[model samples]
Target: MAQARCPLPSLLLVLVAVVLLVPRAAGYPWQVCGNTGSFTANSTYQANLALLAIALPKNISSSPDLFATTIVGAIPELVSALALCRGDANATTCSACLVTAFQDVQNVCSLDRSAAIYYDPCILYYSNDDSFLSSADNVASASTNRINLRNVTSDPARFNRLVGALVNATAEYAAYNSTRRYASGEADFDQEYPKVYSWAQCTPDLTPAQCRVCLAGIIAEMPRLFTDRVGGRVLGIRCSYRYEVFSFLNSPVMVQLAAESGNSGSPTPAMGPTSVTPSAAGGGEY
Candidate 1:
């Protein structure tokens, strides 16, 4: 039989199409460009923002808490910025995430004087208004995987109850027990999906009460946002929580619990507490 071959141009075109059609593994970043105002190019506000982009990443990566806030310039040109890395993210990852975030926000928001950009590893926000640097009052955004849990369809109410218990406990641990204001835990469910993993975090600068309130605000939206989904996350400026059927967190689970037998409401903590020691500098936090 004669050998078959694709034309060079045709083969190249097909390859290009395939590459272009492939989805980004990390997914697209979520961003909000504030309507507060816009800054003109080459303005002092733009210059101050440029300085912030360089300073925040360095400050956050070096900080023990993996969080940093700064104000550059003075008066109307002041640019206040905050950057926070996920508790499990290493310094390198945190720095890189923020560096890219600054670039991404500038590109996505263009000349907007206030904007926030979020990624899996970190979040960056800068504004002419300094209140955002300390306030936890921002609205949260939810991201849910399209696939529903196969096991949950059989008993959605039970699944919902379990999810509520898992996230609430995780939030409590993050707010109260964790030094970094972050925690991850697992809950035992039915056999079909034996476990549900959850993670909760808040900006380390926030007080325990503030963290709890911030997390509570987002948790309240779960029924409307997550339901029986296999995975979902609510991301906010000050706090966030994520849940999945499969494990998506680092080791040393901070809390473990099992659903009570029969038609009980909440899960009970498993015996023996698990503690996480904070990692060394350049590594992740507890």
Candidate 2:
């Protein structure tokens, strides 16, 4: 029974209900706020920053960068946004997701100088300063894109073993692969099904070691038992990890390249201890 085929949920149907009813419950999962407090910055400086971020995704929109600048906001924090469609999604679907994330985040965050938002479909974020290209913010957050799981849950230990194998392999690939700091692929687990489909990505500036550390930190969250579905993620300023039964992007190739150019080493600020944790049981999953 656990091995039965599970269909993909209607992202649109569920997302609409989730946004109207339980959006705040998400607690801004992909957030990295510096309680140090956000201060206002120069407007001219922030606009330039936003441009760099929007340019990363070529297929999303030709004039999104221009549209983003038009959205009136305070504080000139540098801004840059990224939207990566799932490897299996078509261009139209990816574009739609980007539009939704962009609009919703604008409403959700309002006028924050430095903020980023990630989605299962894509991500969009900007700050009044260009601090992102060279470094990631310790003030970010993320969560799993929910999906249904099969029989693995019947044996908690076996299910965890599968998640472990997938996340670990992806973490290794992400930390070491300089040409592309992102990796998503399958691995066998419990010798059943594909067992795992894991993904790992780091801010372009982070060193491979840092990416590994971040990925490993999240992978530790796989518990022997299951609750909802077989999906979770750890989003940090420097890197993040995602895993599910399905591939999340529409890229034609198995191993893909991040198209953005330039690799300046930006320093992500230190993530000070927060009472925060990743598990519902409590604490950052790491």
Candidate 3:
């Protein structure tokens, strides 16, 4: 018996459909889940999650801080969730980020009762418990690009110092001055290191003091964590900081922040050309 083979074009279309239908692997820079417990399928927890996942993103768009949270269902099956988009993200970008986040959280955490997913543009976290809202979790996590710096700078230590200064200043502004609890700016070292761009953010829910503590913790750990990497970010559930020689943020937003923070001298225009090679680093939680 001879079996008829499918046409090449038909086979190609079938393959494309299968690829599109497969749940994407986590695209987060880092993800962490709690070991507290797991929710049963077709249960109250899952149902509440279904609702919160849909509502939070929409709610965040109306807030000035681009942050939203919700508590759904009753005790024992309750799901508390939150989403925070990058401070510079517009409403459209924020919505899209959360949509992708909703899928990633479900795919990566699966049955975990508590989970946090960090993307370059947003952060999503959920749990059965409500403590996450007030706990001021200072736990820190880092994802560093393992690749060595491509163009070596003669005085690595000096360059590192300049980077630290830029990030530290931005962190301070984010914690104490920015109403949105976010700030970003650029530093130039007279073409020695070209342009160094940096951004820092803290969850708006935190008090200024708590935000400062969280930002300082991660900033202090950056040198040890990123080392010689050209670009990397240190993240905490409450705070995060990222920097590179290139710009990945909205220019107008960053310039406005710098002006308000009295750092208006920092360049707002794009400096030369730059590129970033997405890293395939794994997740870590502190």
The candidate scoring highest on TM-score is: 1
**What ranking emerges by lDDT with the best candidate at the front?**
1, 3, 2
Q: Candidate 3 — worst ten consecutive residues by lDDT sum?
A: 277-286
Candidate 2 global CA lDDT score:
0.47
Worst 10 residues of 1 by lDDT: 266-275
Overlapping backbone residue pairs in candidate 3 total 0
Q: What is the C-alpha RMSD of each candidate to the true structure, in Å?
A: 8.6, 15.1, 11.4
lDDT top scorer: 1
Instruction: Put down candidate 1 lDDT per residue, 1-286, tens digits, no spaces.
Output: 9999999999999999998786332346877777779999999999999999889999998999899999999979999887888887899999999999999878878999988777878988788888777676554322222223443654566777777777887888888888799988787787777888888899988898888888887787777677767678877778888888888765567767676355644322221223333222222335
- State the lDDT of candidate 3 residue by residue for 84-190, as single tens digits: 88877888888888888788778777877787777878888888877777777643321222223554354555555556666776666666666777877676654
lDDT of each: 0.76, 0.47, 0.67
For residue 39, give model 2's deviation from the true position in Å: 9.1
* Residue pairs with backbone overlap in model 1: none
- Write down the TM-score of every candidate: 0.79, 0.53, 0.74
